[model samples]
Target: MYGDWSDAPRSLATLGYEPPIPGLIGSSQAMMEVYNLTRRVAGSNASVLLLGETGVGKEMIASAVHRLSQRAAGPFVKVNCGALSESLLESELFGHMRGAFTGAVSNRTGRFEAAHGGSIFLDEINSTSLHLQVKLLRVLQEREFERVGDTQTIRVDTRVVAASNRDLMDEVEAERFREDLYWRLNVVPIRIPPLRERREDIPELVAHFLNVYSETNERHVVHIQREAMEALQDHDWPGNVRELQNYVERAVVLAESDELTVDLLPPEIRSGTKRPPLGMSAQAFDLDTLTQEVVQQGLNEADPDAEDLHSRVVNRVEKELIAQVMQACSGVQTKAATRLGINRNTLHKKLKEYDLDS
Candidate 1:
């Protein structure tokens, strides 16, 4: 599922005055291609659609585009379309007039108006409702829009940089997104590669985060052991760079010496743990070769008509899953709870119940 970047152009590196993309810290071939495309499209007025999984740094790429463009001196505004309701999102993108609705105490300037003469990054644009998408299309096509409850038209020279974790073409096919809007935003599409797709960059990312967290936490953790680095490279980072960053920060804070050893890393990474597929059935998981012996022993001991057998198996699986996620998060309850998709208090109760609190 991953592609090689060995054939990517090296002209920029050969004649480098400074790194082409300053804030992005990857030298992989895939990243180099992204950098090349970003720099190529920066001078134009076209809309840029960034596609990638969450945590792949779309916002960072958007920022780089703005900084490298003619709008470098102008303001850069951002909004998460998926983070707000349709009504609120409408008001957020286009300002609402005073007395427009309940709680509209005073006149407000929305993100579009605030981003005038510069760029506005719409993160998770796939989440916008069709009604909002119509308005967004108008803004993109005409470069003008009126505030909510206002008949007066306002025009601005703002660039649009939209991003989505989903395939917008699929959204359009499903009638969830407007076709015109999709084409309008897809003028210069750039796909940000996930961490697993660019494993070669892991060591660089680790070193960078180590330096950052070390300085922030005033720690002497400057070096990472070879085994630790290998584990980091081997593990599948589902959360991408953000996950790696969190682990590094945790390791730095817990470091007993200047070196980051295997003991300081999360258990899953140190042990090269691989997660089961998201869609794998419980029965299939129980049949895994690694657990077959245990399951068979339990089956041999338990009565065929035991009423608690199912619940017992469920509890055992849940306990082991929680334990692994806990170790992966370095025992941070909040992080573990988030990874497990449970509330913190609920996780605390489970931890105590499973005798994993210690």
Candidate 2:
């Protein structure tokens, strides 16, 4: 899993290589606070703990710290703690000498060693087991470790930067994490606000991702159409910058023209206000997702032995939909029926059948 993470090159912006996107933050007050904290802590070698929801750019912040620090000229290594199994992870982080384990074919360098003289980012660090956390704590305390199969202590200068979406202190309180290690890593804490909290930066982020992905994919897509940008800005961006980058890239690749339009955007973004309106083009009623979601929710909540399960589920969906359309059409039965692509008579019959008629 670690094989897939892209390292933020030291000179991302000034260099021609695609600037690594770590969800750039704009000037929102919450963002400014993060920006200020990052700047203040970047110059120090103290262990840093980045707190935020997933895809909120903790990695980017980590990269920013590495770049702004004295270690900018050295290698920057990254590891996703949640992505590896304990044995494999221990071996991966602390090099496993040949014959250390069955698959230990040869001696290899661990990420910390590779990051010597620079920084090593431990992403999703809260996933580590207490056993490993203790080892990590030891490293932070002594900056010394041995290979998996060897007892000889090897020392290296590596800056430890860690991130987690879950509250580590809560983990500590729950005994899922070691409090000592938490304090060690929490030397400097920085919280990155989710995309929704920094809505003002949406437009600029869209433009930045658009340019980067366009060049990366050699796509001619130039700009986001106004309506598309509006849609983007309206989204809560539950996935944060990573989601935004991926969404933009998808639109860019699919867009036939130079501009990204609402038509090219995902249903979530196209209908920013909520789910796409009931009736749309043959390609866009957007029923599949809505149906699945509602159906899954019903199944999950309903008793398995509930009588007439099929009829009950269908009736619930029909009732909810009719009520929704009726409300959308301001209780105008005819307009609601028209939008629903059904005859007014059938709409009324179903509405009455489901007790949704006024």
Candidate 3:
């Protein structure tokens, strides 16, 4: 955990490395790889498919690609495909004629037309129905599409960058997404790593968010307490950077002093409690059997004359619980912590004490 502002680098530039994308902050190797890929593909006209879990900054990457591309000076239009119905999305993408269906008040230009000579970021493209996918495929291949009610074709010099939180190939296989459209949008696929995969970047992210929220909320919470930083770093962050950003904003708004203390953090973060561990149906996950093993180990290792015998048994029970959750999560610490309903920092400490870190 970062002990002070002096110990944390706010951005890649602060560490003497120029940021590949101006606004991106992380300097971790995982993000470095993503930066490299983004830089390489930004100049090309090929469609980019950003693959990642939700809140992993796919829109940022998409924006970076457009800004770094030849279409920087042109209009940059964005549309969320999953947010609209098939008919509505069709009219949204390709302009609809007046009275196209019923709500077409006037001849309004669509996203592709508005994005002429620029780029269009289609987010949540996987949510598009198969019917809409066919039209999208046409626009990608022909660079032309007709409005919802108009028959005349409209051509545009626009680039497409699509994003999805789900595995598009899985959708393709399941017949939820068109295979042809999948190949079209997947000309360059970039998989954004989740926050848990890049723990080293947490301090920088926390620092950045602290500065942002402090200024926005008129708070002076500049310094982060050591314990608070540790809790932030140890979190599983299943919701990724967006989640971290929200938490930091909350802390800044609630801070009593200039420092962000552990008490300012949410209860689940400080206590490491999420929910009870899920007991998968497997022989090795038999709680009774595991409890017996843990109790036996406790009996052999504990002091014979110790007055805290009950505490020792309780400790053994906790160890067994942690071990079982770890097994159920395939030894993934973040997932195990979440399943065990404990803070990851607490889980890590318990694992080390019980010699279950492996």
Name the top TM-score candidate. Answer: 1
Which parts of model 3 are misplaced by more than 4 Å? 1-18, 274-358
lDDT scores for all predictions?
0.86, 0.82, 0.86
- Judged by whole-model lDDT over C-alpha atoms, candidate 2 comes out at 0.82
Better of 1 and 2 by TM-score: 1
Task: Write one digit per residue (lDDT tens) for candidate 2, span 274-337.
Answer: 4322222222335777688778877887898888879877877777677777765556666677
- CA RMSD (A), model 3: 12.9
Per-residue lDDT tens digits for candidate 3, residues 1-358, read: 3223333467854565535467787889889888888987989999999999888899999999999898999999999998998888899899899988888999989999999999999999999998888899999999888998999999999989999988787677456889999999988999999887898999989999998898989988889899998888888777888988999999999898999999989987887654321233441466678788888888888999998988988888897788767776656677677677889898889999999985
lDDT tens digits, residue span 302-332, model 1: 7899988876766766777788777655566
Model 3 lDDT, residue 157, Cα: 92
In model 2, the clashing pairs are none
The TM-score, computed over Cα atoms with residue i paired to residue i, of candidate 2 is: 0.68
Clashes per candidate, residues 3 or more apart or on different chains: 0, 0, 7
Better of 2 and 3 by TM-score: 3
Cα distance off (Å), candidate 3, residue 34: 0.7
In model 2, where do residues sit more than 4 Å from their true spots?
Answer: 1-25, 273-358
